[model samples]
Target: MANISMTETVLQCHPMSEKGFVDAIAVHVDRAEGGRLQIKYTLHGLVDGIDFPEVAQPKRTDELWKDTCFELFCGRADDRSYVEFNFAPSGQWAAYAFTGYREGMTELACAPPQIKCTAGEGIFEMTVTVDLPESLRALDVMAGFSAVIADKHGRTAYWALAHPPGKADFHHKDCFALQLEARSAA
Candidate 1:
């Protein structure tokens, strides 16, 4: 028997002294039966004043980080291996694997994830579901959820689970604040 031990969590943006265009960003993560991880991100505030990209295909795209996009960094503490996932409101997505700190970049082979995005009344929402990698299917994992938001004023801000004491580096170790426990065998 397989066990389902997934919980939905709403994540908050890393606090900073200075405020940006977005008043709030909500990132939610949960695991579904059959080894899938669902991630939803909602941007609330003056969305009309934000500069969001305009793409409609859910196909893989490069350089999405240059604009407004939500991202998740996942890895296990036991090893330096990790994966970076990028989801755009324009329905674009990408996944990359790293052997170590920015070394050996490989485009991960993955099925097209389900994604949806909508915006109205100062709110923008995006949802995506990706299959858990074979390596992480039955092990504890930590993840860092972040977003790059651009404002109508041409200013961009970085949001994450935790921002280290220097520049806004989403890959920093401290950013991995959320943890998911492994499922037990039945």
Candidate 2:
């Protein structure tokens, strides 16, 4: 198993003036044997100023990124194909398979992820766990963690482990910076 915790994420620049509503974003990743992955996203700052989606029945959904959402991306080191997962605070989620960087995208059919969200004084958090698609289960993997944060004031900020120059492109190859070795058979 491999465990990783990200240092504070970098907030991408936006056209609107920033109020610094959110102070920090941190992501913790745990990759277990047999393709089980768990991720925890923690946001520290003024929780009331951040807008989160309303809770709904947990199901597969699209466009979760339009609000406050946590995302995960992973792929086999030897293949161009990759997978992206979006986890909304509302318990809805989305998964997609991509042939390459921003190429060929289709909804990925898999077991629904287990998502848990909590809010408290000055902090917000979401935890999600899912099984990796069968194709990616036995290979070395590269992964990226990111989030889309929307303030109640209609302003949004992009947060990622690393950002490509110019704009916030989570699909860029550079964002896949973490390396995880394949788990060997017992």
Candidate 3:
């Protein structure tokens, strides 16, 4: 078993028809104990603003936009925790979770602390890193998990290389790297 921690920046594009973007800073810690994995997440950001739609209709642009953001975090399993939040809209928070097993775990799975957001411009950033279990190395597991999450989420998941480890001032600007991390017991 291995324990890992990672910091990732999450960016979600607003509905093509809508304006503004949703950005979040997420921090995650994962501890692999036996067959079950324990994870924790913390997220904070604005839900609606001048860039986002704000109307009072069920299917209006504003409602649709916000709905899209929330639906992104809706998980299909019982052992996951999903949280949707916004700085506006009464300052209240909504949360849901899957507290059990999630089917189909052949090789990879979506890392916990999945994020959803609206659309906008500018460089948004989040950092997710992990404390690896003694038996596993950080490089291999982190890279694999990150690729799997990006594949499953598609455009909803966006990542860019801020800084490559050990390469002084050399970065991959054109390539965006979105990653998810998961583990299995040995």
Candidate 4:
């Protein structure tokens, strides 16, 4: 395996949502020689005010975005198909594949991701490592990192690497601003 490097990025909250107690959300992403993709999200804010469900056994679940959740979207730079992954602080996750922008959604089946989270004082952090689908490993990939944050006061904010003109649509290609070099066997 080659030495993997991580790219750091800061997410911006959508203008439509009020940026309450959250100061900033930062993400670190990297891919290994094979298909392993690792991402870490560090949120700086009034951590206690963020709604967090009790952590349970890690499992594949749906609709994690209803609360505070972290997300990743990735696809081949030359193709329209993409994958969306949702990671919740509660150890539950969901993955779906799309034929195109928000089209043909289907449950994705792959190895389960390893997720870990910790919060203290004013910081909340989560790390997720998963195996990328083989189809995406041989080509350069584009990715979008986003999050849905809900505070104790019932305020919800959408954060992403970039936002489209109309609304906070993570599915829009504009959000896939990060380019990740391909990892193929030499």
- How far off is residue 16 in model 1, in Å? 7.1
Task: TM-score for candidate 2, please give it.
Answer: 0.88
Highest lDDT: which candidate?
Answer: 4
Q: Estimate the TM-score of every prediction.
A: 0.89, 0.88, 0.25, 0.96
lDDT string, candidate 1, 67-157, tens digits: 8899988899877888888888888989988897678889988877788888899888888888867788777888888998887787777
C-alpha RMSD by candidate, in order: 2.3, 3.1, 13.5, 1.3
Q: List clash counts for every candidate, in order.
A: 0, 0, 36, 0
lDDT of 4 by residue, 1-186 (tens): 475657999999999987768999999988777768899999999898998877888899998989999999999878999999999998999999999989999999888888999888999999999877878876678999999999999999999999999878999999998988866544
lDDT of each: 0.79, 0.81, 0.26, 0.89
Error of 3 at 184 (Å): 4.8
Arranged by TM-score with the best first, the candidates are 4, 1, 2, 3
lDDT of 1 at 48: 90
Worst 10 residues of 2 by lDDT: 5-14
Ordered by lDDT, highest first, the candidates read 4, 2, 1, 3
Off by over 4 Å in 4: 184-186
| True lDDT of residue 117, candidate 3 | 29
| Residues 1-186 of candidate 2: C-alpha lDDT, one tens digit per residue | 343323333333333425487777777766666777777888888899899999999999999998989898989767788999999999999999999888999999899999998899999988888888998877778888888889998978887777777678888877777776666544
